[model samples]
Target: MLCGCVGLVWLYEGDVEVAVYLIWLALVFDFLDGFVARLLRVHSPMGKELDSLADLITFGVLPSFILYKMLQQQEVDAWVPYLAFLVAVFSAIRLAKFNIDENQQTVFIGLPTPANAIFISSLIFVDGSYPSLLSYPVLLIITILFSYLLVSPMELFALKFKDFGWKGNEVRFSFILFSALSLLFFLHLALPMIVMMYILLSFFVKIISTT
Candidate 1:
């Protein structure tokens, strides 16, 4: 959560790049929380609850702040920027469902908060390169679209690996390869692309599975 707090500070300081990097760092730690818990064979309701709280701050609130600041920067109407908080609101609902939904063990029922955070935070680069692409209207649309996606009934795949083998993991491996190459070739520009690729890849996998 410190990373998230620091990100908010940097964001307020007008250092958006640093704030975005912090969000990425927080995501890494978020993944580690689960991995370490499993590694130590220590699992409890308290730990799970704490994990969700940390996620709310890092993935939910931090990203919303970033989006809020972005909209504010656009100099839109006074109350319009407040809409960015919808990301946090929907994120909380998504996380709450995740905690109780047993069907989400190997797949997500909607866009995961972390992925949503990454997609929103990565928009900083788009704003940097193509200022017109993220105008007030566009950002508002993104806010509403993603807010709905957070709680929508989209079946997104999880990156959990039962084994490192090739069989039964074709889609996962392909996704990893695509993400790696995108990052290698595009750098920060790949952040949002990777998230989009993840969603499309999940849909593709589902289609092939039902055939």
Candidate 2:
């Protein structure tokens, strides 16, 4: 949470790239906290709530701050930057749903907050390679679309490694392999593409299992 606060400060001060990096660092810590807790068999309700709170700031608020800054940097209409907060609102809804939704054990019923954050940040990491993204109209559309995606009913596979065997871990393994290739080929742009690929691969897995 402290790191996220600092990142938010950096974002407002016009140090966007550093802010994005800090958010990513926060992600590493977030993952480790959960991992270490599970490794030690210490799952508590308080821990879960704390995780959500940290995520709300690191993944939810920080990403929106980045988007708001990017939009502002682009010199778009005044109203456009505020639309970025929609991401945080939807992320909160998604996190609350996850806490109560027993159905989402190994798979999520919408885009995960961290993935959405990475997707939004990765576009800016490209350093203005995609000029269309800077357009106010385009940013608004993306903001709304991502907000909806955060609460969508689509099943997205979680990247957790449940087993070492390939039989049940095929999707996770394939995703990692392809993600590596995507980064090799597309560089920073691959981060967003990998999120899109995650959705497509989930559908493919579902179809193949049914057939």
Candidate 3:
């Protein structure tokens, strides 16, 4: 609760970098809650429900707030900020569906909330490094494209360690390695490029796996 409140305050103050760090802290709490539950064998129905609610606020609401801040800096019309909220709406649906979807026990069928949060946070960081790219038209287009990715059916994203080793892991591992190098070399400027690589690589892997 403290982390969530701090994150909301950061968002309200337009301190996106601080908000991103707070969201990472929220993720840490999320990890510990599950770990503690399993460690003590105290997994109750209430715990599950509370975790979901916490996730909605930490991952869904906070990231949307950052996007809203980015859109506010744009010179576009009013509808642009509203459109950014779609990321939040889709995130909620994704989380709810994850809770009910049996197949996702092994792997995610869509973008996971943390990954979405990281992607959004990376954009905020990137904007500081590349202000010229955050024009109203470009930000609008990016919002629409990412919002589509949030709900896109054909995208097969990897969310597990197995998807990173041996046979078919070659491309995925290479992509991650290259992405790491890019980040080390270019810092936040590599964010969107790396994310694009992830999406495209995942799409190609899915295609090859199917055929």
Clash count of each predicted structure: 0, 0, 0
Give the per-residue Cα lDDT of candidate 2 at 157: 87
lDDT (Cα, tens digit) per residue for candidate 3, span 19-136: 8888878878877776687679888667766777777778877888888888987776877788778877887887787777767654457766766776777787677777887777
lDDT of 1 by residue, 1-211 (tens): 8988898899889898898899899989989888998789999988878788888888999899988988888877889889999999999999899888889988999999999999999999988887988889899999999999999998989999999999988889999999999999998889889998998888888788889
Model 1, TM vs. native: 0.95
Clashing pairs in 3: none
- Candidate with the greatest lDDT versus the true structure: 1
- lDDT (Cα, tens digit) per residue for candidate 2, span 1-211: 8878999888878888888888788889988987898789899888888888888898899999888877786776688788899999999999999888999888999888988888888878564687765577777777899999999998888877767899988889888999999999988889888988887888787787789
Please list the residue runs of candidate 2 whose C-alpha ends up more than 4 Å from where it truly belongs after superposition.
Answer: 207-211
TM-scores across all candidates?
A: 0.95, 0.92, 0.81
Cα error, residue 136 of model 2, in Å, equals 2.6
Model 2, position 154, has a per-residue lDDT of 80
Report the lDDT of model 2 for residue 71: 75
For residue 188, model 1's alpha carbon misses the true position, in angstroms, by 0.1
Give each prediction's root-mean-square deviation over alpha carbons: 1.2, 1.7, 3.0
